[model samples]
Target chain A: MREIILSFPKQFKIGFKAAKGIKVLGNFKKLLICGMGGSALPGEVLKIWLKEKEIKLPVEIHRNYSLPFNVDKKTLTIIISYSGNTEETLSAFKKARREKLKLVAITSGGNLLKICKRSKVPLVVVPKSYPPRLALGFLFSSLMKVLTNSKIIRGISREILSLESKIKLKKLEKEGKNLAKKLKQKILLIYAPEKICVLAKIWKINFNETSKVPSFYNCFPELNHNEIVGFESFGKNFHTILFIDKSQNPKILKREILTAKILKEKAVESSFVFLKGKGVLPKIFSNVILGNWVSYYLALEHKKDPLEEKLIAEFKKKMKV
Target chain B: MREIILSFPKQFKIGFKAAKGIKVLGNFKKLLICGMGGSALPGEVLKIWLKEKEIKLPVEIHRNYSLPFNVDKKTLTIIISYSGNTEETLSAFKKARREKLKLVAITSGGNLLKICKRSKVPLVVVPKSYPPRLALGFLFSSLMKVLTNSKIIRGISREILSLESKIKLKKLEKEGKNLAKKLKQKILLIYAPEKICVLAKIWKINFNETSKVPSFYNCFPELNHNEIVGFESFGKNFHTILFIDKSQNPKILKREILTAKILKEKAVESSFVFLKGKGVLPKIFSNVILGNWVSYYLALEHKKDPLEEKLIAEFKKKMKV
Candidate 1:
């Protein structure tokens, strides 16, 4: 597992460096940060932090191979790839360029970098070192900075100053008592209502990979209709139903709280984790860092390493993917 | 359960009524259907049939209230509501109106019916009876006819003619003599590719409500990424994998077969249901109906009625939805 973790860092570090070099934003019609796979976690982290902030323009994170067909000149397309070589990002970049979209790019030295250089696009070139998954912080921070510069939303570096202390290996080990211990008997059901819900997915994956437990994520309004009914079958299998609650709509919030109470009557176990967020960076960073805590504690309970996904690498290799 | 089964027909007959009046789809940019719950099943059926026929006109199915922020003119929006009302569909109808999207509707006569009537949008008012779940056929046939009239896709009159007798329910009843009894001893996994996978999901749901068994659904490519590893974990637990091999790429088909072999090697029970589709409609129709047959057989094995989902209805009442 350690060897597997070590191999992806080179690609990730490049993303980190690029994030550090970005100019902050102050305002925009819309902000869309596009990335996929491990590289996209950073964009997701940014979304979690911005979960509560009042932003005028919709901040979106696109993960698919093409730009949103709705996007136009007023939209800002953030082309991101840790290796600067993701095919989907490149395809979207081409479309964004064709649409004359306002663009910013984050990547290492690869096709993405070359394209950015050729086109004179705002490029954040990171140090080439780790895998995209590990470099989540780097990619996310860059996007966060850019959003701040555009004034699409405010940045919460001061609120998240504690983030620097919390992210380290030693701090995670010590703060195990502070965060996610509340989830010991809980089943984490993450909610991200924003377009793409990048951070919400990250919470689910981390719960699976780190905690080795069944976890799920859903975008808002969508979950309101079908999955809510699914709770009827849960019949007390879970101790807690953690809503990665973010402020999407006041009406939605009221509905969600009512829905939670309704389920508490039937669920064998139920609890809510009201996530605390400040700005785009802090809100998302807080969730990820807190998730990291909860998952690690869960690992301790199961007596398993939080880092182990015993068969994933072997499965990937066998698939020849 | 017996009562529920008897009630499906009345709800389904709404389709026969809806076929009476509908608009032609001329100068329409694309067709998008907005539906949720039981009504959505028919649209899924139509999409798979269309794809099987290589019908390539862009068709979008909105399973939620919000349209993908990109839809616009040249787009035809279809609102389907068996009960004549679905909140998400209503919200979407409003959006479609705002976007000036061409509108055609299918409903028994609810708010959606009233709205369409007051407006110039054409409405195919299906006779509303039975539970929406049982009315899947009517929606499929009516939508197919409208799309056919617009030259969006070829007509399915022959397909409808064939559907009357094509569901040789006894065929699966025979398969049950051998395998259905064994399903009780293992976990059931259902696989379907994106194009026509509704049958796959339908199959799983039927298993859940009928046999009351645990089942899982994995779309291809995505499954190739994560769930392939899950099969390796069963050192001793009884498990079964069902591969719904429909129209998949040869390479992908090979990958699925290989996955089955690997599961078998890991001491898991697995079966392959090789589906032969005469055409797109036959393939989609046969698989969906096959799902109904499989559920019946499994229910018979358990001495349970295939139509018992009282809990699902009870849930709707509790949610006040």
Candidate 2:
């Protein structure tokens, strides 16, 4: 697990190269990225990054089986399944192919890859050793490359190249360890600015999968509207982590501060993890690594295997039968 | 709160009339529904209903400030704010107006009303007595009327008219009370099939605001991929409630049964609430009303004021500063 985390930065380079020759020819007006669980995550990350950069294309992330009803020829559908066998993604892929919609795919070696080859759908096959969650870097960068190659968006090669140097793993790991200690025996709640709220979801998933704990998340401004009230009469073992980005609106910044203060008054505990690093990719991936570390160390604290996801495997097997 | 729930069905009739003469002119390719908290919920409900009916137009629900980056001339932007003053929706309304995009507004009365009138954007003003969350029937039906008037979708007038008769409130309230007693003093986790998962979210928010308890939710197929694993070492007082619809894919139905069995094996408690009612509106609204009663009765059990939201008021006051 430690080695996997250490080697994570290399995924950007490899993922970029893997998609070098793959491209779709279309004047796509929008995007529908379909996947499930960890495979669905890169679309989320990409949506946030694209929003931050003010890309005008609407990117809808779908995690369910079959295609979202709105999908049309103008909508470019990108199917992602790390195992190349995710049932829902394959279902969507089949539907998209039947509709003759412009399509692309990202996977390792599995049914998704095989079908993509049969259909001549553009694809990028990444390494498949790690669990889908741990293989985020590969999935995300490959999807980014697909967008760039298809001329759906401008190239971020320079940003991708610098991502490895920007990540300070040891510092983030130490901080994550400290966070895990504070979060020990505590149900986790995560919040981030709305546009970048996907980071909070990613953190919650890490805590849930790696640490084997029930963690939940929602974005700020919106959470302030409803979820904040849930803490008014807090009588549970809950700890909140706020991912603050200094680049966000000052009003949101103030709301975060006041939200934390109100939670404190209600006897709910919260800690802030400022998103630190230059550029959007650095800021996001740095925090992503930080969360990975927190979950890793917490797994050790709980005497759990960080790499084990027996329940998912079991459910999938049952699903097949 | 109980009275609000009781009169909820009437909102459908009243809301249908609210937009009787209102309409928009455009060749909309998609939809961007901007809102927050309770105000945002109708869009979620509408999306699920639309998907079930196989409406091909894409509806994107936005909860944050300003507009989603993808908003363009071809997108019909519907801004909803029960108070007519929600900050985020107002911001989106302003952006849509500035961009000269086709726009509509739904509200009881607030700055949103003033702005829409000033700009000549089509608007529907429903009765403003209930809290936004409590006014789901009004918000959702009015939005539907707007779509109907614009010819974006066919009228479900018959379905909306029959909704009240479909709800057996006395029977559902008893069930809600029993469920509330079971959920007492436990953190709530909700799951529904992916398309209708918004009901799970609505239920979670109801539990949070009405009962002042922390709650979380996720959809099936996706949760099966990642979140089910979190229960592997469950160490908290978490109670999961599954909202199952018999109309869904048999594969999903099998997954739900298997998921419940596995949760039991892991010693995590779970219960199933089948979504029972004929037609889409009845099925959705019945379960929605059931959740409301559970939260209302749970509030009584906790001795919390279901109608009181002092924290939200305080947050709003502070945000104004």
Candidate 3:
């Protein structure tokens, strides 16, 4: 688990190179990226990036079976399934093909890859064997490359190159270990600025799957409207973690600080984890790395195997997935 | 709260009538519904309705300030703020105007209404004074009428008319009251089918604000991918509510049943709250009404004032919103 976390940044370059020749032909009006679990994470990251760059294309992530109701001929649907076998993604891929929409598929090796090859659909196959959650670099970069090659978005070569250098793992590992100590036996409530709320969700998912603990997440401004009231009645057993980005809107930044203060007033333990780095990629990837380490260390603190998702495996077997 | 819940269905007819003379002139390619808190619930419900009817126009709900990156002149932006003063929705409305997108506004009475009236934006003003969360019938039906008026979607007048008759408030209130008794002193984990997961989120919000308790929600299939593991290590003090819609994909129905069985195996107390009626409007509103009763009754059980969001009120004052 530690090795995978340490080498995570290296996947970006490999992923970018893997999709060099793959592109879907379309004057796409919108994008529908379909995936489930970890594969869906990239679609979300792309959305934040698109918004940050002020890209005009609307991007929607479909995490269920088939396509969204709004999908049309001008939609470029990208199917991402790390294992290429995710039932939902496969269903979406089949539907996209049936609809005769331009399609792209990203996977390591599964039925998705084979079907895409057989159907002559464009695809990028990443390195196999890593858990989908830990394969973000590969899935995200590959998806971005496909978008770039398709002329849907400008190239992000500089951002992709800086990831490995921008992310400092040793320091984050130490900080994560310390944070994990405080989080021991406590439920987690993660909050992030609305623009990058997906990171908060990713962190919660890590805590659940890695630490085998219950964690919940919501974005700021939105959470301020209703979720903050949840603290009015109870707080002792829950720890609030705020992802503070210096680059966010000042009003939003103020909301985060005030929300933390109110939670403190309600006797809730809270931590403000400031996001580091200058560019959007580093800020995002840095948080992702920190979360990976936090969940990894928290798993060790609980005497659980971070790499083992026994319950998921069992549930999948029962469902015949 | 009881009186409001009992008469909730009646708002549908009143809401539909409120927008009778309003219409935006344009060939809208998409719908951008902007609002926050309870105001955002209507947009989500509309997305589900659009999907059920397979409407091709993409509808995106923006819960934060300004506009999404993809908003353009071809987008019909609907600003819904039950209080009309919601800062986020207000910001979105202003952005929509500045961008010169086709505009429609829905509010009881607030700054949003004033701005729209002064700016000559087509608007719908519903009855005032209900908490935005309980004002769903007004906001939802009114927004639908705006879409129908603009020819964005087919008319839903028949469905709107059936809401009051189809949702049996007496039966749902009784059921909700009984469910609240079982949910007392327990944290809630509400799960719904992925297609209408918005209902799960609305249910969570009701519990958080009305019942003054912590509640979290996620959808099926998606939750099966990661969240199901959280139950492996913890279950006590948690009550899981499953919103079972008989009309969902058979595969999804199977997943929900299997998921509940797994939760029971993990010793988590589970309840299957079947959604009533045939049409989408009734199924959704019935669940909404039931949630209102449960949250209202739960507040009574805890001696908490269901209508008072003291924390939200205090926080907003601190933020000076």
On TM-score, the leading prediction is 3
Better of 2 and 3 by DockQ: 3
How many Å off is the CA of A234 in candidate 2? Answer: 5.1
| lDDT agreement with native, every candidate | 0.59, 0.86, 0.87
Look at candidate 3 and tell me the lDDT of residue B85: 83
TM-score of chain B of 3: 0.96
Once fitted onto the true fold, the runs of candidate 3 whose alpha carbons sit more than 4 angstroms away are A232-234
**DockQ of candidates 1 onward, in order?**
0.12, 0.64, 0.66
Score every model by TM-score.
0.69, 0.95, 0.96
Give the candidate order by descending DockQ. 3, 2, 1
Per-residue lDDT of B277 in model 2: 83
TM-score of 1: 0.69
In terms of lDDT, the poorest run of 10 residues in model 1 chain B is B4-13
Q: Model 2, A8-27: lDDT tens per residue? A: 88888888888897888788
On TM-score, who's better, 2 or 3?
3
Alpha carbon lDDT at B254, candidate 1: 57
